[model samples]
Target: MKNVIFLIIFLFCLNSYSQEFKNITIIKSDKTEIKTLGTFVYEDDLIKGIKTKKNNLLISFQDVNKVFINKETYLVKNYKFKKYLFLKIINGNLSLYKDKKNYYLENNELGLKNIKKDEKRLQFVFKTGEVSLFINKCKAATNELYNKRKSLILSNLKKIINIYNTCDTSSKIQFADEVIKESNRPKEKVKFGLSFGLMKLKTDYNQPFSIEGSDKNFTFVGGKVYIFSNIFQEKLDANLSIDYFFRKNYQINDIDYYIKNSTQFTKLTIGANYTINNISKLITPYFGISGGLLLSSNSSVKLISKYLDLPSRHYTLSNELIYNINVGSYIYLLNQKIDLIFEYQPKINTKLSDSINLHNNSSSFSSLSFKLSYIF
Candidate 1:
């Protein structure tokens, strides 16, 4: 119902603003004068006005004083002056005479005027003479200009009315109402949270060692350490960890002798980790590759083989491979800034120069590493 009412009001406004032009008609002042004027032109026709030498009394359609015509002499007049216009219809020759001016209009189109030296007006006596007071040609010119102007106005009005009638007033009203409602609504403030924390790591590992003997022989022991991280930021991260020992023991087999050794060693490594998935908000599985130099100190061997007759001494191993590949998931305990993590990074490749062999020497050494990490 509201939409129908809106459309009706819109169409009504369109029709009311359409344009209208006045119809003009000319009427001669006197009946006798109309007969003498030959009745060639209607009184209501449009007329072109011409400026003359006289200021107050000029010649135009609606304002001519008198008209006179004879066989050879035709005359036109205003209030203060008169002009002579001579034409021979058969020969097509016209001659005009005023105060000091003379002009000829023959077969060519022409008109005449009486010049007043001081006044800025003239008596325009046209070729048709007396009735030149009513300039038919000038009237036609005026009608043409009038019609042109009317046509332009009519076209513009038609366009305006069409656009106005076709407008969607209901949509415009709805839009305005929405704008007002939004302007009256209140705005809310936003808040943000921030936090940070640190992580730690621990690991257990076994390694083989050698002691000086009458014959060359090797022994092995199991050792474990806890690693702690300095910093961690996800996506791209860097951390340094220290290995603290939990167990140290060495055992040898097939040597026909015995030697005691302490497998105690401290390892320091700088590693980078990349995390992939986080499940249940508690476990995050990450796979990362890292390579850096490692140093081990406090390594000692006791001769476990008496038949080999070996002595005990301290040996150092520096610049070992720290490349450990692992697939592991971390559990978040504190779950805020810290993650409790367990990872297994196995030595998939080898370090060529560090491997020792008596009969045949292989170029690589392999090992497995397990670490518990506290992620920040």
Candidate 2:
């Protein structure tokens, strides 16, 4: 009776252990499927199969059609001359898959030994009808390649989705093929734009020579033109710009003396801009910073020593450095090739030097600009 009880307990333990292993179904290339009880282990292009009461099996990825393990299905995919095991998340005409790829890096140590390390990265796979698209989720690569290709990937995905939604079963294959063809084509790397806008400038001078009363502030009208290039990515831009300001006049009065001045400021700037939002959309916002040379030309100040009784003294202001910070937006039209831009530059500061003494003086200003640009 005790022996019978032991045998029953042993059989029950065996049954429980078998239940712990998942059921895996492997579909072969010849339209045959095999059911195996094992724990599936995947390493690159091979799946290690540890079967019950059988020798371990090593299955080549190319010979396998699909794998069902742990109640989940994985499809074998080929991309960029590499094989990927994709976990199918959505099963329909258009499917989404989670993909994993293993990468090996070689390190040389002591000039004689080579060490190899493996890294696994996760990526996304989209299957539209019969077309497959791969999206990389790793940011380890340089921004140049990633930025240039990111928009292409998004555009292809959008096209694929649209085609899948509109096409019927008979025409789906043709549309999928078109999408694949378009996706495989090389995309544009560089985009160029030109901007022209109006600007307003207000100058504030500091301390020792602080103007009194209404003369403390001076406002001027200006116009600026800039040529900008999209570099590295769509969200970043490199710009070269020039600005011309109209003449502004001011009058200063002290108890014993009066002074009159007229000034015109011009600037040549080189800078960069970073867009905070979607660059491919109809409207995108950006912020920029620039540093340049400011030329204060036709600037003459006349000082009457005593109420027009003494001869007036004339002095000219010298050129100085101009630093600017601006916030702006781009409204895209004509398929994003043309844009209308509106920008508000709140802080533009420069230091004007005295031509005779080379003494530095501060000038602070602000401007609003409107420009039309073309992207190529």
Candidate 3:
């Protein structure tokens, strides 16, 4: 009897470990369908799926109607056209989705409650008071839902918690895994980050013939792409980032006359960061610096209505180098996984130009950016 039991257990373990993901096809509408490639399993009141190939997961949308396939095996589920697909998770951790709207199952039944693009988050509850429904990947039905339905979600969640006396152990754990598998966000979380709403620069001297203060405009758009990892399971953290910026501007300075010019360039940089006392389940502050080469190319300038009307504009293609630094903090929003970020960058570099001393000089530029981020 012992030998037989051991053999049965081993086989079950082997089968679960060897589990292969099948593709899921959802008919969202007459014009749309969703294709998912992941490992899927069914349990009472729960559907668990994971994409080991991509390291992604999805849970919640507990109700499934059919499993079918065309040329390939697909786990097909049915949903109503305009009801919110609430993923009720009991207790589990998984990957986060960047756009909750995109994490939706294809069937019309399992969709965001609203059709508005700007709205993207809903709260769900599973175990009355013991466990609550939280979104790893957030999607809003519309801005209206965020503004109007906030109270309804809170009320419903609270009421559900008041009724259930015990946690649904099996469903809760299973749903959490499902949430992770169905997520569409990046697999890794970014740290010590920065994003620019807008960065502007300017420089000018007097025109040759007139005192028209030559005005120039330098606008930059860029952000840091990096990864952050926790150390000692808590107190310490690390951040690695890549910084790049694209700059372009136009200027008309002097009141006496007009001197117009525009230029465009691209810059790249890489850096790493370290944080202390970071694992406290609260806000953590961090600092870091990065240095890299800046590659810039200049676009021709036009001297229209000023000097020569023949070839009114002059164009030059050139490149340059630069250095960068950053300091920032991470604030928790929904929990440890969701965050709001703010950072500052002060850069020093030789201006991009084509052998013109008038355009060649070294200066420091400064900027501040705010970003909202979520981690899985």
CA lDDT, every model vs. true structure? 0.35, 0.52, 0.40
Better of 1 and 3 by lDDT: 3
List model 3 lDDT by residue over 1-376, tens digit each. Answer: 9999999999999877665655555444343545676554444322433333355666333343233334532233333432222232211232111122223212122232222222344444122211222321222211222233334344443333233323232232223333334354344555444444333443323223243332233434454455644333333344433334444545564433343555555556665554544656576765656555545454434344443433333334444444345554565666554434444445443442325334433323344544344444
Per-residue lDDT value at 220 in model 3: 45
| TM-score quality measure for candidate 2 | 0.47
Q: Cα RMSD to native, each candidate?
A: 33.1, 11.5, 22.3
Q: After superposition, how far is residue 230 of candidate 3 from its true place, in Å?
A: 5.7
Models sorted by TM-score, best on top = 2, 3, 1
Quote model 1's TM-score. Answer: 0.31
The better candidate by TM-score, 2 or 3, is 2
> Of the candidates shown, which would achieve the greatest lDDT relative to the real structure?
2
Question: Mind giving the per-residue lDDT tens digits that candidate 2 earns over 305-356?
Answer: 7766654455666676656676667666766655444545555555445555
Task: List the lowest-lDDT window of 10 residues for candidate 3.
Answer: 90-99
- Report the Cα lDDT for residue 150, model 2: 28
The candidate that achieves the highest TM-score relative to the unseen native structure = 2
Kindly list the per-residue Cα lDDT of model 1 for residues 1-376, writing each as its tens digit. 9999999998888655332111222223452342221212212221123222224222444433333333232223221242222222122222223211322222123344322122222433222232222122333322332333323232332232233234432322122233345455443222121212121222211223332322111222222222323223233344445554433555444344454434344444555556675676887776655554444334433334455355332333334556555455556575443433333434332221222322211122344454444333
Error of 1 at 81 (Å): 68
